[model samples]
Target: MSMFILVSGPFTDGRVWNEVVGRLRESGAEAHPVTLSSRPEADLETHIEDVVRLVDSLESPGELVLVGHDYAIHPVLGAADRRPERVGRIVHLDAGMPQDGDAALALVPDPSVHELLRAEGGPGPVPSPGPAQWQRWGSTEGLSVRQLELLSRLAAPQPPRTLTQPLRLAGTAASVPSSGILCTAGGMTVELVEALVRTGPPQFRKLADPRVGFFELATGHWPMVSCPDELAEVLLRAAAGEGRRLTVPEGESPFLGSFLFDTPERPRVRNGRLDLHMPKPDPGGAQGPRPAVLFVHGGPVPPHHEPAPRDSPLYLGYARYAASLGVVGAVVEHRLHGIADYAQSADDVAEAVELLRADPRVDARRIALWVFSGAGLLTADWIAAPPPWLRCLALSYPILAPLPGWGAVGSRFRPVDALRAGGGTLPPLVLTRAGLETPRIAATVEEFTAAAEETKALLEIIDVPHGCHGFEIHEPTDESREAVTRAVRTVLAHLEQPS
Candidate 1:
């Protein structure tokens, strides 16, 4: 069987390649998901060495295909450069090809991105793209909650050093056949494509080379999630040495067939106090013992596993996307809110992680905690005194201050007071608020920022009203989805960073 190595982009582990890898394997390809070491503290040479090791381990006399997605184009290309003989072709899947003098973070037009890099305390040059510029380009319309969580995880502060260091690709374009899958529907523009191409090394200067190919898709950036069949076909075509334009059907719903799991309710009692509703992986292929995400639902009175409102695009959409990405999402019922108690809710998240870890199919190292609104408070408390195995966190629209009596019969919660009291160092925070400019949401974000001593980012969506708490639940307008998606993508990229 032909061998394929799938390398994921920054702020992402191997799980992001779940759909792509599954499709490749179903088509009889021997696929291996490679995890790259992307710690901001690590030097460029060290990162290159890590990829070399993985590629060498897979070395065989038979030809192999190396696929790099997004930020991974750098390391994957470096690996190919190191061992071109055993490798068959290098596929740049909607990714940027880095040259010796090109800066990785320079491509991102966000000054806040530099703030994040600086917060990470790395010695690297920050890109000058101001927050205003990035805000103009980043969009988050139609994103699911799971997608938001993925974005939040990816949105962490990146190390400035990694962005400042230029990629060093030494081979000529003839050494390997290259292909680019640009998803136009995901908001990629022809102008951006031209800019990316122009930034390539001298070897890629000749656009007419048969070995060089470019194709655009009218799907979200995550074609594997939004349009898997189309993406699979594209990969197959690339593998067969056929390069042609591939586009989604006219007026086809982008959300069709995007979710990979059945939304079944597997309610079970755990730790004698919490209820866990574990959904099965979406249809197509089940990757056993998948890494799990503990969902802490918002609302002080809503059921933990209630069907998300149709207007809330982030909830169901996010769950399905995470499952499609090979993550086992567990919605935890928290205390006094969402059908459970605060203590029990925290315990439930920990227990779910433990259970998944005990299962042989899970990687254990990739478990994550995700919560929103009131549940965000519970998640933050839990993280303050975290379990040893906790891998990362994704908290959105968090209520940092309990106020005097938020849920008490007559007491009111004062966010300002809470911020004053909880003045300790905090985890990296990704804060999102509605753009309709309500005083409450703005005040909430302002309070949280003041209390946070660690890295914190604020994503303000324009035109969203304050009452639309679950705006990201349903298919948002194109503009909102794009805004949210960009922020989420940045967060996910940050989480994928090596600790």
Candidate 2:
């Protein structure tokens, strides 16, 4: 028999787990819901102590399973680390994986909330939003109106220190087996995680550990409120290690596929963060420096990924294909290691551009920048002020607007707002839209296109009706091939225009 300990996240307490605990009990399992210190000054340590003390007080003698939801995972992990011997299993329910010295604020997926917490001289305790604004925390899908009212009525402001204080760990708890409950409505799924793991990022690779199990809930982030019975059932299943297991296939990278067009060997030279692919000279003779297309691959990829994006098969293929067109193709590796490092990554892009211009083999007066995916944010700056040297700008399945709940952090990176703010004509812009893109992301692209129309920006749209996000590498159909070819040709045509 397993004794279950449930810890609720911020803006609520043990009461939030009432129905879930009841269901667990009805199933013949011993369950306890924890309520931490409500004092305004209570910090992370206080909450960790609360969980540790609860474990000490439990009189049950069987396996102990610690379950944490959202921000509560911090304390749960801390306590588990301190009492590793007693904890049989640890479950992370719709919460981030925070390492030692990480503050909960940094783990917040919402750019707006992250900025607020990072700013100085803010409110002491963060107030819970109204039920209508619950999406800011996580998706409210599947939550009934009565449940929303209950949540609003019982919500409490969270202590500031609970989010500010860094989580400290001795790493002992890492040895304990763990389970993860991913909420699809909250923007994560087993499929997405598996895809990321396939990208060969070092941090995501740890998820393939056999000791870890994963389960997905169709409900929103607050499983306790939206689907308590289901949550309880999953909790029991997690204790039994009966969830999906993530495995890494031993073969070529899944993110890598055969390029639409093949190219002959090209000269590859590395200059700091940029990989320059030099085109073969024409049969007549060698020409002067040629125009360059700098490919900025999109990602919040882990910093420790081996080979990096520049060396990845997809990016390498893009660069090589550019060279095949008789133009210098360049791939830049920037430090977009995590969501919070967008500003830094943008700076890296600027630096890479300057480096490309300084090279003698590249034409400094003509350059086209092509950005993809999350890297679309870096385009905000270039769009706001198109330099004379910038021939064209291309974006593929780019995020043009800030994601919901991505408040201030995404504000600076909104290309849609940037175009509106610039209120000036931009160079020819080519955008490739994915018909089957995720709704939230497609919304951003739609918002950007709408802004372009309003601002009368010079834009051409390419549609991949049957394509998903990253269709070039993932779709592999004739449509995907045609779209890529058209985009590359359009960009090259712009580069060839009078300068």
Please provide TM-scores, in order, for all candidate models, with all chains considered together: 0.42, 0.82
| lDDT per residue (tens digit) for residues 116-219 in model 1 | 55575445533322322222223323345566466445433334555556677676434677777766644454443332223211122344355766776676
lDDT of each: 0.52, 0.83
Q: Which pairs of residues clash in candidate 2, taking residues 3 or more apart in a chain or in different chains?
A: 111-406, 112-406, 112-407, 112-408
Report the lDDT tens digits of candidate 2 across residue range 1-499. Answer: 7789999888899999999999999999999999988789999999999999999998877769999898999999999999998899999999877777767775665555665666787647777778787777778999988888889898888888898898999999888989999988867778766755654334666788998999999989899988999999999999998888988654324235545556566899998989899998878886789999999987767665765788776778888999998999999999887666788888889999999999988899889999988788888998888898999999988877655333325567878888999834578999999897767778788888999899888999999999766666553678888999999999999999987
All-Cα superposition RMSD per candidate: 25.0, 3.9
Model 1 has an lDDT value of: 0.52
Q: Report the Cα lDDT for candidate 2.
A: 0.83
Q: Which candidate is the best by lDDT?
A: 2
TM-score winner: 2
Steric clash count of candidate 1? 51
